[model samples]
Target: MSHEFTVEAGLVIFSYDGRAQFGWLDLKTGAYHAESDGRCIPDAIGAIEFHSDVTH
Candidate 1:
């Protein structure tokens, strides 16, 4: 099973899989950066909630 959720922050969208895997994608440039790749997640990205039906 897999779990995922998305958060919209201004021009970018943050995507996270329930397993310490997350990244932000720039809407304009289409750039993506993962937390494990040395990219910093902004403070604006606060708590995240995974819906009960968020598994596939």
Candidate 2:
């Protein structure tokens, strides 16, 4: 499956099959994908979410 968040934070791709995974993140460029660990996302999600001070 996939997920997309429409905001100044750009889009996040949430994917899963038998295990949890993430990808396609722009990160420092201000746009990114859910390709890592993050605070805003669920721990089980195994995805990267943005921080309050997310810099570009």
Best by TM-score: 1
Write one digit per residue (lDDT tens) for candidate 2, span 5-41. 3434333344444344444444475333444554333
Compared with the true structure, model 2 gives a TM-score of: 0.19
Worst 10 residues of 1 by lDDT: 47-56
Candidate 1 at 46: error in angstroms?
A: 23
**Candidate 2 residue spans exceeding 4 A from truth:** 1-7, 18-52
Every model: Cα RMSD to truth: 11.8, 11.5
How does residue 17 of candidate 2 score in lDDT? 45
* Cα lDDT tens digits for candidate 1, 1-56: 47555633322324443234345555585455453574654433333333343332
The 10-residue segment with the lowest total lDDT in model 2? 38-47
